[model samples]
Target: MSAVYSVKEIYIYPIKSLAGISCQQAFAEEMGFENDRRWMLIDAENQFITQREHRILSQFYPQISDGKISITFQEQKHEFSAYEHLDNPVQVNVWDDKSEVVEVNESTSKWFSEQLGFECKLVKIIKPGDRKHESSRLKEIFNVSLADGYPYLMIGSQSLDSLNEKLADKITILRFRPNIVISTEVPHEEDDFTTFKIGDVQFKNVKPCGRCIMVNNDPENGKLKKEPLKTLSKYRVVNNSVLFGTNIVSLNSGIINVGDEIIF
Candidate 1:
């Protein structure tokens, strides 16, 4: 019998370095979702901070609805009403590059401060510039327009299952935090897919996704597990970075749905 492949899951992390939401369908863009990761929290010095340093952010819940983004933490909720205007400004560094972005303002900042028990501000990435993927295999400079890294991270459902089969304890797949999860034609076949298309959009494979300690942290309870990480370290090492999935830059913009057949 021939094998079958399809898209099995879709997820979007509305806030950078926070918990993500599982969706049945999502609009794909060159820079990721329409508004995903557009807003991030930066320190007083305008430096970017992520789960790599502050795991407390894993407890924050963020959602998008009706042109507004609402973030909830502890017992309080703060909503941002400005999606059209990019006026409130602050300087923030995505990595080493600093870009001026609109801060979410006092009302939103207060909620985060109380939740994380720290002084921090919400900033949005709106400035369009040349963002590139550093690959020795490429002959020309590969570029993108949004925040750091590629637009999407794709994983195979079977791939995770294969990994879990080797583990002593079963863990939820959300720990990986992938944007697209597809059921490839064969087991681990996604590892060979260079370019895939769904609807009218084509995505070019960029690089292997590097795993981190965040994968061990539960997105819901803000807790970490050691067994899974220890298991991955044995087989998932790549270029000194622990890799789990493939990062892709979109070749076109379109809506993608769960169960969509991806043509390679």
Candidate 2:
């Protein structure tokens, strides 16, 4: 059959809750995209921190290199070793799951503490298998990353386009933070396909992503406002959850690129 949708964009969140980096192509690894959500910041209580509490965290943009990731905030840049010299395997609570992560370094944690103006530690996954959340849907897909629930999020381009048409001010897909953007003709078309394939990998849409206030966070200004959320509730509310995108789990591993056809 002829393809009905094509990948419009690909993104990876190297650090959970921080800014995401857009890419023309990405590798679908076990937990998530390669280098996606491998690192995250946690509070002194060993609980994961996110923009939900510190809205300004949306301003921290991360760019990953071969051996390091440079985060920029307000024109200032701080660099951290991506996967070198991991120290101290500490257990962290990401939402409800207690996943084990290693400290990137003391200096990196110290810098993040200063930046966020609080005591926090920078931690990274030792490997894709370092953290596993048991699930029966996909036997081989229990390896969850720092992501809230699933390894990937897929949003139909038409969904955002439809949402934008209803609002006075339009927003970018970055607000939704989807890893895969499929160009479809119908809004929320992603919901129609529960199983699909892209390149050598297969994916399943677990459920509609229930959004939170973090969507109000403006990555451009490090500020929060009741938007998209408030408007989304008008029509997207279901069982007390305001959903905008679909949470996805991978069935295999492979490279996906922009403009690639999504075979259903």
Candidate 3:
């Protein structure tokens, strides 16, 4: 029975470093959830840029409807196709892993670059698994999206609950940007789960997600704070890295819904 734990939340970031969209249910795929981290912003050098360096990136939120994505910055809004044209294929470096992606369009590219006050291109992966996972933590390699690494990230609700007890001002679960959140009696329980199932899809916990200063970014204001990470380092640090959630890879393609029991 898939009853030990249940899915509490599902989230997807259409563009890397941008605000995420919450969903009641999500499709599971080898690379990642559909439209999750499929698009990214790259500098002139073709190196991927993220909120880590420019926190304001989180202020731009994307919403998809009828195969189109719209992002509003300041007071202006622009829309682009979810799957941009494949004719403008380009090579990009997502932290060392090279992948082929397509430039969205001239209009959207100009809009974003003008708003961000920098010369950057909006790119989208034409297909799933465009970028292969490059991690020594796992023995086998699989495809991944524009996410830092891994296809999925799962965190227990209690983990944030426990962490909030130590924080002076608690942060939202969105701060962790997990693709899946399971309700569990214990904090960080997903860390020990090697193999599990959420709804109809089987998943494997491949590695512990090491957090960085990105966690310090305030989801609401796109401002940086010292709270969560500063407090987390005291108790969660291991091997010079502060660990929080578990990175996972789907075993098969299926549907994962909120309230779906998590079987371990």
* Best model number under TM-score: 3
Instruction: Return whichever of 1 and 2 wins on TM-score.
Output: 2
Give one digit per residue, the lDDT tens place, for model 2 in 66-170.
778999888678997776646668987776677889888888888899888899988888776777775544454478899887889899988999999998988
Model 2 residue 68 CA deviation in Å: 1.7
- Top-down lDDT ranking: 3, 2, 1
What TM-scores do the predictions have? 0.89, 0.94, 0.97
Clashes counted in candidate 2 amount to: 0
lDDT, candidate 3, 71-161, per-residue tens: 9876989999886664967988787788999888878888989999999989988776578866687778888999998879899999999
Clash counts for all predictions: 0, 0, 0
Cα deviation of 38, candidate 2, in Å: 0.8
